[model samples]
Target: MRSEFCNALVGRSGNENVLFMTGDLGYMALEPLQEALGERFINAGVAEQNMISVAAALSRQGFEVWAYSIAPFCYARPFEQIRNDIAFNDLPVKLVGNGGGYAYGVMGPSHHAIEDYGVLLTLPNMRVYAPVFNEDISAVVNCLSSELRPSYLRLGRGEAPDGYVIPQYAAWRQLTYGDGIVIIAVGPLASTYIGAFEKLPKTQRPNLWAVAQMPISANPLPSELLSQISSAPALCVAEEHVKRGGFASELALYLAEGGKMPKQFRHHYALAHTYGTYGSQQFLRSLSALDEGTLLSTIAEFAPTSV
Candidate 1:
């Protein structure tokens, strides 16, 4: 994703207002950007809070700025600075969080960024995005080019594409048509669910949606996506993060508060607590029962409530 960001930066070389800041990470993926942009790219030496302040100040100067760092440091370490300097002031600072959603599986809970979405979603006028496909990077960078307010771009590790065209919005990218069920996958989980779903016979498969961006407003509701989801008889949310305050929790809360809760709902997410074990991304997912085998089992046992 950092590579894509740099490529987009080069594409916008004529725009002198663009600048990039890093928190002493992305040594491998960021060097290309540095070579291309020269002094426009900055390395802030692991001081995340200071980086956020600097980015906000730069934005005040009528520059379009983006701060880059690991998931934990990018948003969590400098949270207070971000809330005040960026969101409160309504600056056009863009924050890029790499290695989100267990992308750093071996780094333990301290490196995990399960709560990033929930935390940033609460801030006023903050837009949150996560790409499921390589093509999705264009929309993300275009966001940098055109966003009028503060925005956060959540990214996974490596460069795996979703193997499908990324739609501009989640609801509009209906992967299938059916009233039986709606399975929505956000971030890298899209590939996992897509691969697992192939094992099921056509008779039991449900409708599918690849949710690329979080439609969070002051109301904190996904009302637009829900309008599309309402057509299904049941709904399921899949995410690499824990259920608490993640996509599923957010969706459920929105529906309940608005008095439009879906009667038949199911969600596949990480456990509320991790064992603190370390391994590759896929291994960690398996330990928490977010694997393809688990999905198959759940599908076989699914009752599909009548509500």
Candidate 2:
């Protein structure tokens, strides 16, 4: 995906408007970017704050700047830089971070970016986009090209799940439609819900929505989509990240404000209270109860009855 992003950026050469900067981390993959756009690409070493500041300054000068790094190092460590320099000024800087959540599983807590969404969503002008698949990534890249505000795109480490083919860069996508229950799954975890759906009888399947771009500034809850979900007897949200202030929490608040209370609303996300020791992503997911089996159990337990 990094290669794809770099290739896309390099293809925009003669325009002289696009600038790509890295924290001296994309040595192997980003060589093409540096070679093609040498004057534009700046390797600012491991200093994420300095990288963000420079990107913001470049944006102020009317250049499209993209800053790349690992998720935690890029956002959590240099949060002040993002909030003050880029977000406060509403600069058009594209902050792309790899290894979201347990994508860096074996690397442990220091590398795990489980709280990135929670943190980024709190910033006033920052827009967050997490694609579930490669196609969605392409769509987001296209969408970002036209965006005017500061945006953060969180990319995964491994291959993305095949949820749905998103032709456009909409904030959300409804993959399945049903009346009994509504399930909102964020990022690659949407595929888990899809897997769970296959385990159910056709009549037992609930409505499912895949959120491609979860932007902080943008209320992704379109009225039409919300209305459809509101009609359901229950709602459930699934994510690989922590439950607190993540997608589930945000959607719950939105539903509360809309005055559409489901029979039972549940969150099947990572437990924010505990951070596990280093392990494979699968082991960490199982340990945190963010795996498919747990999700399936949660859905079965919360099966809605006609109101």
Candidate 3:
């Protein structure tokens, strides 16, 4: 996906105006970006904070700057830089963060970015996108090219799960619909939700919506779409990150403001409030009940009337 992003940016009509900056990482896969877009690419040598500030400054000078780093370094380490530089200035800087959540697995808690969404979502003028598959990544890139505000794209380390094939340049798409309950699943967890849906009889499947890109602007949610969801008997939000300030929390706040409260709700997310030792991604997922079995059980237990 990173390679695809680089190639797509290089082939754009105004490739000369594109700038790519990284914290001296991506040494193996990002050589071409530096070789081809030499004048437009910078290796900021491990300074994540400075890199963001520089990217914002360059964006102000009319360059479409993209900053890349592992998730922890990209967002957590330089959160203030992101807030005051990119977000405050409303620069057109695209933050391409690799290995979101437990994607880094054995890289340890220091590298895991289970709290990035919670942090990034608080910054004003910043949009967040977590593409579930290859197609979704392409769509997000296309959207970011024309977008005038700061944007962040959280990507996994390996091949994404195959479930929804979002169309190129499409910002959002709905995967399923029902009246009894509304299940909002984001990122790769959407694929897990599809599997959970299969476990239920067709008649038991609740209304479901898969939003790959959850923008920072709270009011952009289509009122018609939200009304349908808010009208359901119950609502559940599932995501790969923590519960606070993540998709579930944000959706809950949205519904609360609309004066529609579902009788039952659940925010199935990580509980890693503290750091831990290095381990495999699968192991970490199970520890946090993000695996298939756990997710299915949670959905079954919270399935509206089942409550």
lDDT of 2 by residue, 78-123 (tens): 8999999998998879998887777777877777778788788788
TM values, all candidates:
0.87, 0.89, 0.87
- Residue-wise C-alpha lDDT for candidate 3, range 239-271, written one tens digit per residue: 778877788787777668877677778776877
Candidate 1 root-mean-square deviation in Å = 3.3
**Cα lDDT for residue 193, candidate 1:** 64
**Which scores greater on lDDT, model 1 or model 2?**
2
Best of the candidates, lDDT: 2
For model 2, state the Cα shift of residue 269 in Å. Answer: 1.9
Q: Which window of ten consecutive residues has the lowest lDDT sum in model 1? A: 164-173
Winner on TM-score between 2 and 3 is: 2
TM-score: model 1 vs. ground truth = 0.87
The count of backbone overlaps in candidate 2 is 0
